[model samples]
Target: MKILTITGYKGGCGKSVTAIHVATYLSALGDVVLVDSDPNRTSLSWANRGQLPFTVVDERKAMKVVQGRDFIVIDTPARPDSSDLKELAEGCDLLILPTLPDIVSLEPMLQTAHDLGEANYRALLTIVPPKPSREGEAMREELRSNGVPVFSTMIRRTAGFQKAALAGFPIRDLTGRDRMGWLDYDSLGSEILEAIGR
Candidate 1:
């Protein structure tokens, strides 16, 4: 079993969105379970409303459930400094930190990845914008220099995601994709799996 944890230092960085998509896409290859470690239970609520394919557990009860699962995809809270976040991250095979291309978002992501390394956790970047601004490309180059393994595929900004969130559903279940978000996510999932050596 391979445990993949989706985490970030702040909200609106696409933590839950990436977790749900990765879990759904990974399940196509093997059995998978979604674990909600966010206090808000955002992933759980969406799963309940949409009746998604996998199961979601309460934050406090996740560890016990993790011990028994073949694959656990955790949606972690944005607070990277928390002891619980460290514990959850330590238990995983891979840690995924998603952030927008903005410098405000990028700085914390860099710091968190550093902290994860200090705690002996392996992490990678996600949710990078497709049409990056000048500063965004600069941030990517900076991350590369810092030795962070960024995915070649990025989750572009899109209204399809907003519609799916509003409807409490996954993008794969949504319609009218002028651009296919799942393709990006699937490619991302494959990269993450390979990175984890799973």
Candidate 2:
């Protein structure tokens, strides 16, 4: 099974949101389990509320419990130090660091990447404003320039994500205008599958 850890040094950076969306999209391929490692238990709470299709479990059994699954998406806590980052990334196929379009988030992302040594990791831009602005593009350029692999697909800022989280459903499960939030995550899931040759 391939393990994907979604993490960031800062909270409110869309780590859990990205984890839920990616896990939901990947379920189409095979059995996908989400491991909520964060103390906040955001993913687990969402599962309990919505009765999501995939299984949600705590971190204690994450590694062992994922034995037969196709993908194990781990939603980590905020502000893990360099050593903590290394420990969390152990046996991970891909480490995704979700960050907003600002330096406050980017700095820690870069540091975490550096701490991971040669591990396979990518920085994903999330909570990006939909309005046309150079901020998103500039952040991408900065990460690339700093030798950080950034996902081309950026998760745009939308009330849909918050609403979906509150209602205990994936953005894809939402209807009407709120459903538009699925597009970016779909693209991201595809990109990730391609990257890992899944």
Candidate 3:
């Protein structure tokens, strides 16, 4: 199985949300399982509250169900200690770091990147505001100029994602405007599949 880990320096950057959606996309290819390593059990709770296409288990229970799955997505606690960072990078096929497009997120995200020192990973910009707000594009350009590996698809800011989280279902499950959020994740999943297949 290809193990993908979603982590970040702080909360509210869409780590768990990204993990769940990525796992859902992978389920299309084969069996997939999401392992919630966060002490908060965000993904696990989400699965418990609503119906998800794939299985979600706590890290403690993961070993039991992970076998034979084609993909394993992990949601890790924010700001893991230094040693844990190295171990996590070494243990995963891809390390996804989700960050908001703001100074509050950059410092820690840059630090995490510097600490990673060439680990196979990509930085995803999430909660990006819509037009008239240039934060998302600006951040993506800034990161690219610095030679950081970043995703071209950004998870735009929308109440749909929040609603999905509350209802414990993927954004696609919701009708109307909420489905727009699902499109963003679908683009991200396409990008991720390309990255991993390389």
What are the per-residue Cα lDDT tens digits for candidate 3 across 1-198?
Answer: 799999988887899999998888787888989999998899988988888999999989998999988999999999887678888999999999899998777767777877888888899999898989999888888887877889999998889978888999988789998879889989999999888883
Candidate 2, clashing residue pairs? none
Predicted candidate 2 versus true structure: per-residue lDDT over 36-70, tens digit per residue: 98999999998888857588899897777788999
Cα displacement (Å) at residue 57, model 3: 0.3
Off by over 4 Å in 3: none
Candidates by lDDT, descending order: 3, 2, 1
On a 0 to 1 TM-score scale, where does candidate 2 land against the true structure? 0.94
Native-referenced Cα lDDT, model 2: 0.88
Query: Model 1, range 1-198, lDDT digits (tens) per residue?
Result: 888888877888788989998888887777678988788888888877766666678767766666655678988878768566677667878777777777676677667666655553433344555563454566667777877666666776677777776677778887667237877787887887777776
Candidate 2 wrongly placed segments (more than 4 Å): 61-64
Which lDDT values do the candidates have, in the order given? 0.73, 0.88, 0.88
- Using all chains and alpha carbons, the TM-scores for the candidates as numbered come to 0.85, 0.94, 0.96
Q: Which candidate do you rate higher for TM-score, 1 or 3?
A: 3
Candidate 3 — which pairs collide? none
- Assess candidate 1 and give its lDDT: 0.73
